[model samples]
Target: MGKKNVSGWSTIIMLLTAAALFTGCSASAGSKPSAELHEKTMHWDKMPEMTIDLDKSYTAKFTTSMGDFTVKLYAEDSPITVNNFVFLAKQGFYDGLTFHRIMETFMIQGGDPKGNGTGTPGYSIPDELDTELKYEPGIVAMANTGKPNSGGSQFFISTGKDSENLNQMPNYTIFGKVTEGMDTVLAIAKTPVKETKPIEPVIIEKVVIVQS
Candidate 1:
């Protein structure tokens, strides 16, 4: 009778181990990949282009490690650029990314998944330049590689008086403006940097968009 009891307990323990292993595997398979993993295995070819109404306005609230700031997008003025930004924000593409470029008294630039200036959303969009709209202080605009229609995910927020000069070269697309949190924008601009890159990374926690 004692021998039979031991054998039954051994069988139960083996069954429980197998069940635990299966549960672990299932949980791992169902979990979403981390941002680091996604970056390594990113396939830009599958990224879809979004369409947004031009008549409506969209506001994006950015919660960064430095502070929070709100940007009011100019959809009517830059429909394609605004739509692209909205799509990326909703998809959580900008989360955990850092503002790689910072220019004191100029602007703070970010939106690269690689935490460097060269990353993109697997695609580039055409320029939506409007001569009527100037790059004044607190203005948010897309960062391009000087080539026409080279705007990608990177963008910069104007800081000091020098930003107005950006208007002379109508290459960057003016998409939004910082309606609130100018102080936070200025604080980010003041962060120490080595050349254009920041010494200590200012992480973007998340971006939320509200349609208006």
Candidate 2:
């Protein structure tokens, strides 16, 4: 299926504005005093040791609270990103984490241990961007801070036509694309959010990876 047309430049602009506003709200929440206290109360140093065979194909089956979906990792196009994601999945790093950032007609982001956008995997990985990979809906990619090779465990799934523009900016690492259960993804995307965060937590039950 093709991406839905978002009307025109004006609608696209409005979507972009909403996205920006959501990001800003998330940022502000992370910086709040209560959020700082929450950070201090919780230990964020847990990182798993993992390994991956770069020679094989990997597919991740995500069983989420909303439903199940599968993404096929592009090992050849994004070796490092795929490897890291596979490793994390095997280690159950994504279990119970909430999709914290949800912008309708944009993307749903998660994989942060903190359930906040600011959390990381205690380290960053180098970017593996492929010019050939466009950010179409169902494209799974790493989320970064616009800095070089700063991707961690945080990632997002493209949900709208605007992702085509995201393809133009090659900052985020494109690692995989959802091959099944996109209907579940779209359902999750329609969830209501306040300050870019889902009003109710959408939990990731587990991530199961299979090698081929």
lDDT of each: 0.72, 0.74
| Deviation (Å) of 55 in candidate 2 | 3.0
Q: What TM-score fits each model?
A: 0.78, 0.80
lDDT of 2 by residue, 1-212 (tens): 23455558856665463343222123532354434222322323433343667777899999999999999999888887887888777767888787878887878888866675666666678877745887889998888766677677888898888666664345678899999999999999999899777888888889999998
Question: Candidate 1: where is the Cα deviation over 4 Å?
Answer: 1-43, 46-50
Q: How accurate is candidate 1 locally (lDDT)?
A: 0.72
Give the top-scoring candidate (lDDT): 2
Write down the TM-score for model 2.
Answer: 0.80
Question: How far is 79's C-alpha from truth in model 2 (Å)?
Answer: 0.7
* Local accuracy of candidate 1 as per-residue lDDT tens digits, 68-186: 99999988888888988998888888888887777776678888655545566766788887547877889988876556776667788888866654544456789999999999999
